[model samples]
Each structure stands twice: as structure tokens, then as C-alpha cells.
Target: MENLFSHPESEPEPSQQDDDALEPFIITVVVPTNVSHAFQGFTDHPHLWWPLDQESVFGEGSHVEFEENLILETAEDGRTSVWGTIDDWQPPLSFHASWYPASTPLWSTEIRVSFRAVEEGTEVRLVHDGWEGAEDPAASRASYAEGWPRVLERYVRFMGGAVA
Candidate 1:
């Protein structure tokens, strides 16, 4: 049975292809807060907004936080997982990080989030890129495309804003 599943010894190497053909996933939202408050809410209060029960390594009781240069998720039992690391930590303006939830840094993707004060409130933009680094760039991008919007909706609600 093991031999039946093995690849042929004469199989040719796969061709190298450009994964950058996939565009970055971008999302923008306006919240009823100033830029500074928006940034603070995103960075300092993710534990309150994040859907830990649905999107966590330990589920339900797990909480996530941004500390120093790392985004960490800690379970009720005290076990922690690193979801990502901060590549840039500018406040009230923008921040960049490499996100790799439930995966290794070797397959990481880049995330950049910016906040700007607008007439209505604050404009927050998120760009998730670097698809070339992902193991299955298209599938990875698709999963995040579905997941990020839900996550951002939670953030928007936490900021006391409606998704328009």
C-alpha cells in the first residue's frame, strides 16, 4: 500500500511559477472614533474583539493580544501561540506585521494596517500581501479573504461603529 502511494522515481521536477500573480487582500472600514483611538482599539484591545472561540488555537477561552513586537494568543490553561510578529509599530498611523496563524514563519504573509482621521470618523485599511511566501498562495489567500472580513466586523462593532 505504501508503494502504491509513492511517486514514480522518474517523475520530473515541478516547474517554478510566480505566486505573486495573486493580488493582496485589502479591506477598509470606517469607525466612529479618531485615528488614535482606532489604532489603540486595534492594537491594544484585540482580546475583546477577536473571535477566539472560532478562530483560536485553543478555542473558546483563548485570548489574543499584541505585546512588544508579537501578537500572541493564550489559552485558559496558559499555553500561548504566536500568531504573528510586528515588523513595524507606528501608532495612530500604521503598523506592519507578518501573519501566520496556526502555521510557521516560513509560510508567513505580510499585513499592513493604517488608520486615518476622516470626516465621519476614522478610516482603517488593512492589506494582506506577500502571497509568494505562502505554501498554497491562492488557497491561503482565499481562506483569509473569507476570514478577515468577519474579524474586521467584530473590530468595527467593538469600536461602536457600523460596517458601511
Candidate 2:
């Protein structure tokens, strides 16, 4: 899974200001399914499972969909938003994206998800990082500490389990 998170040569190297490792938060949960079911549940059927936190991402009447690994939120009024870009799309193993939640429009936050087969099911790990800027970064990071857990709870319920 480390190989999946590595960047290409063309991408700029991380700087001191772009550091997320020092203050990033992570959430790990076990879903009652195989790698494929867990990965597809997050990537393909997110609209069905993802927490409909209207204040975070999609707006009212907007639905999330994937286009060539790009996450989009389109509304009935024809307003479409770029939710995030899937940086890595290795199915049933891992996926990473530059997430632009509605609350943080200044820049994107990085989200890395990894799936591994476990004795009971698949262990899904989520790392939300790349929080730059000022105090908002810290505040945002703290806020997500609460938010991701709720989101993962939904994932667990949708996956037909209580592990998360």
C-alpha cells in the first residue's frame, strides 16, 4: 500500500508549510466484507453510503458520481462542483484523492484510503491530511476527527456491520 501513496516525479516535493504528517488524523475501521466490496462501496456507491452531511460536501438535491476517477457533485439546478480528484485508483487495495470539502474551499485536503483483507473482513484505513494555511488547518483537522468517525459509522452500517 505504500507504493500506492507515492507521488510521481513530476509532482512538486512537499515543503515545510505543506506538512500534514505532524498533525494529521487517521481513522481505521473493519468492514464486514472483502476488499472488493469495501472498495467499491466507498468509490462506486458513495452516494448510497457516504454521510449526507450537507454542510460538508454535496448540496441539497445534488448527487455524487465518479467520472474517470474524478468525484463530482451535480445539482438539479445544473450546478456541478469538483469534490475531489482521485490520485490513485487501485481497486480493492487502495485509493487516494485531493478532497475539497465545502467547508474548506481555500485548498484541497488529502484523503488516502487503504483496504486489506482481515480475519473477519477488510480493514479500511483513512488518512485525511495535507492541511495547509493557518489556524483553520488545525481547526479543520480537529473537526474531521469528529466527522470521519460519523462517516465511517455510516460506512459500517451500509456495509451491514457494527465494526466501525
Candidate 3:
């Protein structure tokens, strides 16, 4: 089967901060479905599979929001973005956004998630890069590395139930 998580030849390499600074962290987890099932549907159902520890800002008529006050707005064309109050929303098959912590120097970073179909399953690749402002890049990378697995596991389980 083809490697669904492979980056495009034109894609730029992740920025490197410093030798001691933590390198860009990328994690890919293959789900047993297509991109439509893996991203749009799975992500839209925040209530069923969102991280319990994180605060969600979703309601009957509001966009899905996160604890860091990031608002996830979906366009009519099926594009999604995590936007700040001032920034414009832009969408792509895979894109980047800022991950700002509440009390920090607004640590800027980008998270790119892509989905591709493969024979065995759908490859959900999550690449979080641009950790330039983090106090400890290594620690930051370790935390996200651990967190994505748990999040993806929950998503996979949830999707499995829907399929069954």
C-alpha cells in the first residue's frame, strides 16, 4: 500500500530553532477510514470525543471553540480554521495555526493534519511545528507527542463504534 502520510515534494521543511531547542514534532496515526470520515465528521462531533480535560466552547449556535479561546469556524465549502478574534480564516487540505497558551508569550506554532486513504486504513497525519516561543521546546514536544496519541485513540474508538 502507498504511504498515505508522506509529505509532498514541494512542502517546505519545518523550521529549526536552535541545536538545543526542540525540533518540530510530527505524529501520524492511521485510522481505518477515509479523510471525510477522519477529519470533517470526526472533528465536527466535538462532544462525543473531545478531550475531557480541555474546556470546549460549543453550543447550539456557536462555532466549536477550545480552552485557549481558539474558535474553530467551518465555512460553507467545508473548510475549517482555528481563528483568533482578529485573524482571518483560511483553510486548506492541510494547514497551520497558532497554539497560544493563556499566560505565556503567545507561543506561536502551527499544526497540520492531513488524511489520505490506504489499503489497510486512512492515514491521519498530525504535524505540529514552529515551536519558537516555548520556554522548553523539548518539554513542549513531549507533551504534544503524548497528548495526540490519547486524542487519536479516542477518535479511532469513536469512529469504530459508528462503523459497527
Candidate 4:
């Protein structure tokens, strides 16, 4: 079967398309580092790149309390959870997480980040799958299609020297 999560020919455009049949959205970002350092920064230093505006589910060392093995994010007003249970934690090479939206049934696809060495830097490939069950799969894909670029751009800049 074709990898639904493979990078599409083009990013989803909200206006021109129906936004109801958009398929997998893949985003790959290259950063200046080897596999080891890239993996380290991705998991250990998430706070540096994770949007500060959003609440965090996992901090320095919070206990996993839920039966479902999820990381909970709470604020004064509301709470949300994005799949945080670690599927694989091998360092400096690959890591996978369940990418499920909080408040939804646990239908998750693996998000695998691979680090490979290149002439200029390490290529970070982020693939978020399991989109078939999303509430609005097309809309979700569209949103992520646009969002990943911005997030990756921030990640690249932050890695380069921009402060959070």
C-alpha cells in the first residue's frame, strides 16, 4: 500500500479544495546536526520549540496518571491532550509517538521522526499518520499542512539562534 503519510505533491489549499478529502500531510525539515543531536533536541528540548501559547502535557518529570497512558495538559480555563505516550524512545536516530487528538477515542497513527546526516545538516522527517479517523480528516490535514511549515520554520530558526 502507498504510504498515505508520504509528502504530497503540494500542500493542501483551503480555498481551492473541498477540504473534505485531503489526504496525509507530510513535513520534512533539515537542521544542522547529526542524528544524535537532532533526536536529543527533539524530545529533551521540546519546550524550546513547542508553542509556548499552548499548555504543555508533560513537563520535567510528571507522573503518568491516566489509565490510557496519556499526557494531560490543563490551564485555568480548559484542558487538551495530544498523544504523548512514547511508543519508541531510541535516541539520536528515531522516535515515535501516537498522534491522536485529545478527547477522541484512541485511534493513533505513528509519528516517526528520522534523523539522517547530510552535507549541510541533518534532515528531520516528521510523518504524522492515522488520519483516516480524524473528525474532519480533510480539514485536519489542511490545518496540519499549513501548520507544520510554520512550526518547522520556527524550529529551524530556534536551532539557528532565535530565542523562544
Q: Which candidate number would show the highest lDDT if scored against the true structure?
A: 1
Q: How far is candidate 4 from the true structure (C-alpha RMSD, Å)?
A: 10.1
User: In model 2, which regions exceed 4 Å deviation?
Assistant: 1-22, 53-55, 58-60, 103-106, 133-135
- Candidate 2 structure, TM-score to reference: 0.77
Model 1 bad stretches (over 4 Å): 1-21
lDDT of each residue in 69-144, candidate 2, tens digit only: 7888776677778778898988879989888855334577888999999998999999988777323676777778
Error of 2 at 126 (Å): 0.2
lDDT scores of the candidates, listed in order: 0.90, 0.78, 0.56, 0.61
> Candidate 2: what lDDT?
0.78
Candidate 3 lDDT at 28 equals 64
User: What TM-score would each prediction reach against the true structure?
Assistant: 0.86, 0.77, 0.59, 0.65
List pairs with backbone clashes in candidate 3.
none
Q: RMSD, each candidate, Å?
A: 6.8, 10.8, 13.9, 10.1
lDDT of 3 at 22: 64
TM-score of 4: 0.65
lDDT digits (tens) for residues 1-164 of candidate 3:
76899867797756564443566677666666666776664545755665545422232333344323353644345544543221322222343456643323366555666777777567777777666666666677777777777767767777672222
For this target, which candidate reaches the highest TM-score against the unseen true structure? Answer: 1
Single out the weakest 10-residue window by summed lDDT for candidate 1. 13-22
Residue 20 error for model 1, in Å?
A: 9.0
C-alpha lDDT of residue 101 in model 3: 36
